[model samples]
Target: MSDTSALPRPLLEPPAPQPNPGASGPWTGLRTFATAPFRARAWKEFAYLIIVFVLGCLATAYLFVMVGGSLYLSVLVIGVPVLAAVILGGRVWGRIYRVLGTVLLNAELPEPPPFTFRPGPIGWLRSAFTDRTSWRALLFLLLEAALGMVVGYLVLMVVALTALVTVSPVLWAWKDPHNVDARGVSHHSMVQFGDYYIETWPRVLAFAAIGVLGCFLLPWLFRGVCFLHRVLAAWLLTPTRRDRALTELRESRRAAVDDATATLRRLERDLHDGTQARLVGIAMALGRAEERIATGGDAEELIAQARTSSKEALTELRELVRGIHPPALDLGLGPALETLAARCAIPVELRVLLPVRPSPAIEAIAYFSVAELLTNVVKHAAANRIWVAVLPTGSDALAVSVRDNGQGGALQPADASGEAVVAGGLSGLAQRARGVDGSLFVDSPVGGPTVVTLVLPLAGPQ
Candidate 1:
């Protein structure tokens, strides 16, 4: 059989399905936010929010009372300053609202409208006055502050009561000295327990039970408060559609620019080091050959060496060109990756299920990332088996992962040295991933299997 005909058949074939290019979906912050415990946590957040609100109000009121003595003093002198302070305070408060909203609501808040100015300091002042978002933000702050005071007061009462109830047994013991049911009475002279209404097992059991119940109920109450906080935060913080779209557009443009710059630099380097150098060496070899013709024996040997060198250089140049941009990428990532997996030293099981074609840049990154990881595995991992998978994570992203059964304890060189180390071209691979606004993580840990995962954003407004 011919050498080509004798080659082994591929273990897995690439899927025909192409991923959609213009698909998009909501950015559901984090998966943890969908859980029941997260909801419970959200409630606790509400309680904290109320507590903060109440404290703010009290502090503001106290400041007004202490610094602004009479109504006239407050209105004329202190009022303007206070109002200015409130406006400044509100701006600061908006940040707090955003943080809390993200934590509890797990939603992106609408950004305030952009500031525009006509010309000078007055222009700036007028711009601030004209800005609808600034006004809305200020209004949100004032409302939150007022509500916070009420919530804070309520929270304080609940907390105080909860604490008191929790310690009721101890207080009752101290007051009566005999554990009495001193209900509706200011001071009970004798401490009663059980039948005697003095220190007894029944009274002790009752006190213990009350303490346990209080402990259990306290957390639930706190959770309710947190829920309310989330509701308020969501209402105050969710960003407008226009703002979200603009932010996404900016991010996409930045990613594209980064990718383009990286590609240009890589292409320049390849041409300089690979093709350019090889052609120069070939020219030098040819010149040496023409000069050495007088010494026929030496000329023959040098010619043979030069001819071999030229062939090797040609091969390397072709490979360098292929590495820069594979023609198979246009066919689709699955086929490209399948070709890579088939060429590996160890057995590779590849599974690709993508219904839509991702952005060319993203697909290229994913393919190359998998290719590099597999190459590393074959060269260094010493594994018998490898698994590669590419799957759609969402409408706008795809998750690619490679796993191998080999010696573990593999870490990114930068992480291992506490400074970036250019080890085995790993840095280059990482930079390429980052260039596409993607992330790569390797988990090796000692003595076994290693898993590498890369998440690339797909085509569309992310």
Candidate 2:
């Protein structure tokens, strides 16, 4: 097999699907329906509608009873708890709907944080009363009680009507009506619509034909209402902006915690393996010096040997600590990369355009990433020049790109199956970037040039 591992992954996500270029006219509505059967997404959304509409009706009933009972009991001042319970119940519904959206609709909504308050029932009740998520959910419940149930009911009824009317001839043949027409004659095998009765073959077939067309159009109708459900659920069921920021803070804190843990783990390993061994050797040399002095022999050589080994070991440990946050990053990421370029074996063109300094953590990540990428290019690129640049990516991120005009068969550390290899070029760099919620993109096409970019956040968790 050929080495197909260097294929470029997407630089960024592509734009959303748009209407087909040639779709312009009467059948545009049904055009999408043709592909509905083959699309798993379409079916999932349609099934979601069928399931949620049932749940919506049940929720609508629950809200009605709770609200009506609360209003009636407010006279006794007991409705306070009732109303609070209602709001809390809405929060529960919010959880359920969010789950359904995630499992069924693939919603990327993050779970909201747990409510925080002082202990005791009074505090809990007070918090519930002031809870923003609960209030939004309660409003959503009220809306679902009125508009939501009605819309679902209407759509389901139309769907059933289409299916039933397609068998209208069967209905007409199976039924007998007790109503007497203007001639005082009993009507049999006929269905009434306002003032008209379908007692003949022509009317039956005409309605059946309309039903058939509706069957083809049902997917669109189902999808439209499902889209509305998704919109409303996303708005009410998902966390608020404050909730999102809190979630991000928690996540960033988690990433920081994990990074610290890894650093400590590495430090422990180094102390146990390398530092400990070196210290033992130094201690042995010092003991030799002590013996030589006691024997009236020259001890200077042994003492000097111990001293040099001790200094080297101490330097190694210091470097390990300094590696945690590079000292060069204190001058900012741009200048750090400039220093890196100066040290590279290949001639380089460097561009730095950072309006504001990023958080120290970000600067450290960018500096080391460029440094490693530069080393990789020098090792494998076989090229004359490397181009490195730092540019602001929107308001929140900084992008650092390294392009090499080399023999461009640089593969990101991936195996033949495209699974990431842990110990290869670009793989380690990719993992290093991801530790800070950053990403690495490689565009190496095997002939001339390779462009690798790193997108780093400007600020820490906010």
Candidate 3:
């Protein structure tokens, strides 16, 4: 005995007609097939093939002359320079192909970093001689020259034949005033069968239909050729792995230098404003005390004032040093995190599970990153309890997870305090982690839990 209410129910009215998903249904497929010849992508690819074919021919001639002439002139004194020029020209041709790919095929290829040659002809020639990218580009041009000529000529001939045949019905009668073939059969068209020429209107119409079908398939042929060209471009035009690594290394070095500069500036500002000002007051107070003693007046009050100012200055100075390199980090990351957990306003459940100690630099980054996370939680999370855990992610990595039960959102959110997020006097703990080739991940949603994790290499940035 089953419940009918829970079993099933059917609608009283038929469902509305849904739009076809472009790949379903005979009608939709037929419509796409009919209209594919006129689509923008098909036309663009065809235009690209035509342009490539023309450029390929010109490039073929230029490369043949320059390469052959340079080789033939190798025994002469000017051969080296001529060869260098040809190599540089290959790079220029590479740029042209990249541009054409962008305009016609809507592909954006990555460009290699520019060469930095020394100030001399020898240096310029040396750069061209050792350039991997230029050599590859030259090879790409050669392949394009050969294949482009073949594909272009073939597609062009097919196009011409189809165009002529498609309009055969309209011009068949005008081809001859009598509308007859050489057989003198009246109403005959130019087409010939096995034993007899086509001599009827229906046969002429059928020939035109075949031409129309060919026109329909021409776009697909164009697409196939362009697809091959795309593969070739991607393989040769983009930077090699070494080039990409060099680029990333340059960027990371710049970021690290910028971070260090900002840190120094901040420390200078803090010393001038807080510790330096306090020390200056201490000096003034001691001077006043000396003058009072010389005049046989009371000096104890001024002396006490100077003592207070000196203590405050010493404390501020100590804090600035700790900000640079925390004393607790010298012991280990575990002890440093424990000290942070003790200082946080919220109750924290802390855990450390590492079998081996990491380098001092990595420990410092992990320490500072955790400290920053705890600070954000106290300032904005409005939470009652927090959790901190330090552990090894793998043989090569150390990971720290700081989580809080609070009103959750990403650690960084776009809001009215955009300057606070992007300006000076704000913390860049995330950037510090990245300086060591580390990563930070944040998992915070709008509710009651937010977790931020920092992963650093155990050995240091590679």
Q: Which model scores highest in lDDT?
A: 3
Estimate, for each residue in 338-368, the C-alpha lDDT of model 2 and write its tens digit. 7788888999898888898899878877887
Alpha-carbon local distance difference test for all models: 0.62, 0.74, 0.78
Error of 3 at 337 (Å): 5.0
Q: How accurate is candidate 3 locally (lDDT)?
A: 0.78
User: Which structure is stronger by lDDT: 1 or 2?
Assistant: 2
Q: What TM-score does candidate 1 get on C-alpha atoms? A: 0.52
Per-model TM-score on C-alpha atoms:
0.52, 0.71, 0.76
Which tens-of-lDDT digit does each residue in 217-274 have in candidate 3? 8888887888788788878988888887776677667777997898999999999898
Off by over 4 Å in 1: 1-54, 58-89, 95-143, 159-216, 230-259, 277-317, 328-335, 351-363, 379-382, 389-403, 406-462
lDDT of 1 by residue, 1-462 (tens): 111112221111112245665443353433333343346664545546664665567546644653344433546764544443443444456676677566554646654544446787556555545555555565565566666676666766776775665666676567765333446443332333344542454665565576566655555555565566556655655455666556555665676677679878987887798778877877887778788775653667667777887888788777766877887887899999989988888989988889998987787778777877887887767789999888877677777878889875454233755442224445455555555565555556556576666767787224
Error of 3 at 313 (Å): 1.4
Provide the lDDT at 223 for model 1. 59
Order the numbered candidates by lDDT, best leading.
3, 2, 1
